[model samples]
Each structure stands twice: as C-alpha cells, then as structure tokens.
Target: MPARVVVGVVTSDKASKTRRVELNRTVQHAKYGKFV
Candidate 1:
C-alpha cells in the first residue's frame, strides 16, 4: 500500500513548543451511505 499526503492548517501556536493542527476530510458512513 502507498501512503497518502494530507494538507493541514496550524490552528494555534500559543505554547512554547506545542502547536495545534487541524485537518478536514470527508468520510462515508457504512450503513447510512452518507458523507461525513
């Protein structure tokens, strides 16, 4: 299998050596057949 590259955004950077990252993606539900 091959790896996938996802683009994310840095939401916060308040801590000295810590940061917050946010990634948005769409996923399909198994039973309901809906995208979430």
Candidate 2:
C-alpha cells in the first residue's frame, strides 16, 4: 500500500524540530452505528 497523507492543524511547533498536530475524524459507534 502507498503511504497515506494526512492534513491537520499544527497545534504546537515550539519543541525544536518536533511538532504536535490535531486530526479530526469520525468513528462509528459499533453497536449504535452512529458517528462520533
């Protein structure tokens, strides 16, 4: 499989070359089948 590309907001970029990112995704509640 090819590498998956994810786009997200950079929440923190203060720690040298490291960074923190927040990804928004929805998951279906198993039994209820509702997105969460």
Candidate 3:
C-alpha cells in the first residue's frame, strides 16, 4: 500500500482593506486601457 500527501499555499500577501482596494483599482484602470 502507498500513501500520498499534497500541500500548497492558500493565502494572499495583500490582506489590508485599504491596500487591497488601491491595488484592485490600479489593476482595473490599467486593464481598461488594454485592447483585447
């Protein structure tokens, strides 16, 4: 018989509310100018 195990990092580096808002807004604005 054999056993297998798996692990991974399920977390976010940005956890601050204000910073998260700023980061998301910046990304959204940048993507808005990109032509897809």
Report the number of the highest-TM-score candidate.
1
Query: What lDDT, from 0 to 1, does candidate 2 have?
Result: 0.91
Task: Report the Cα lDDT for candidate 3.
Answer: 0.41
TM-score of each: 0.66, 0.61, 0.20
Q: Pick the candidate with the highest lDDT.
A: 1
| Model with the higher TM-score, candidate 1 or 2 | 1
What order do candidates take by TM-score, descending? 1, 2, 3
Give the clashing residue pairs of candidate 2, or none: none
- Give the per-residue lDDT digits (tens) of candidate 2, residues 1-36: 759777799999998989999999888999999999
For candidate 2, the 10 contiguous residues with the lowest summed lDDT are 1-10
Q: Which parts of model 1 are misplaced by more than 4 Å?
A: none
- Name the regions of candidate 2 deviating beyond 4 angstroms: 1-3
Q: TM-score of model 1 relative to the true fold? A: 0.66
TM-score of 3: 0.20
Better of 2 and 3 by TM-score: 2
lDDT by residue (tens digit), candidate 1, 1-36 = 659888899999999999999999999999999999
